[model samples]
Target: MKRILFTSTLAAALAAALFMTAHTVTAAPEGAPAPYRHVVLFKFKADAPKEKVAEVVKAFAGLKEKLPAVLSFEHGLNVSPEGINDGFTHVFTATFKDKASLENHYLKEPAHEEFVKLIKPVIEKVLVVDYVANFVDHGAH
Candidate 1:
């Protein structure tokens, strides 16, 4: 009886330790910076020239080098067959280390302002969304 009790206690202790380890591994570290994402969608004016749109895309892509706060930048034309895009043809995403980095780049950077001015003439509608990225466990169903 004592041996059985000892084995059960050992199993319980092991299970508790594993539970704690799993939780600790998944939890974000204290004071770790959450990733910030800046997303932009643009709908060009019907009369805008293709060359001008391409120039705007090129200018936006160059922001990564001009702005030290940019962690990553990507831009692409919409290709979805679903007609739900509401005339938006281009999308750009800029990732930063944190919200402060994003704010500095967008609000204070001269290069960004110039890029904005370059695109303003051809942009019919624009949508921008910014958010802090959240951790997700894709393995978990």
Candidate 2:
């Protein structure tokens, strides 16, 4: 009974720690607003060819150069050991100066439209989350 109690307590403590770390946010420098972040996760269809996926990634990476509103663009394959990814294999993050730039300019850009068309057929599922970044104080505790 004592061993079971200890194990449960340990699990709860570990969960709390994970929750805190996950929610912690980075602080921006004094008086500067944090940029808007557009995060996209993709699960490619099982039948999608590797070459086609590579092409899609190449096109997405190219968008940073094409759109002035895009402060940065990055993409990567999922490398997490966590099994909860729900088959999402690729992740992309695009940063913008503000929400207007992302929603109005970048999203409507001709190159972006073309890139979407390139990716749509090969993707099984897509999840997008956008936020204006803000700092949360959780200084190492």
Query: Best candidate per TM-score, number?
Result: 2
Could you tell me every candidate's TM-score relative to the true structure? 0.75, 0.77
lDDT of 1 by residue, 71-138 (tens): 89999999999999999999999989888888866658889888888998999999999988776443
The residue-level lDDT of candidate 2 at 40 comes to 93
Write candidate 2's Cα lDDT for 1-111 as tens digits.
999999999999999998897677666767786889999999999999999999988998899999989998888989999888999999999999889999899998899
Please report, as a residue range, the 10-residue window in candidate 1 with the lowest summed lDDT.
21-30
Off by over 4 Å in 1: 1-32
Q: Score candidate 2 by TM-score against the native.
A: 0.77
Q: Would you list the C-alpha lDDT of every candidate in the order shown?
A: 0.86, 0.90
What is candidate 1's TM-score against the reference?
0.75
Deviation (Å) of 96 in candidate 1? 0.8
- Which regions of candidate 2 are displaced past 4 Å? 1-27, 136-141
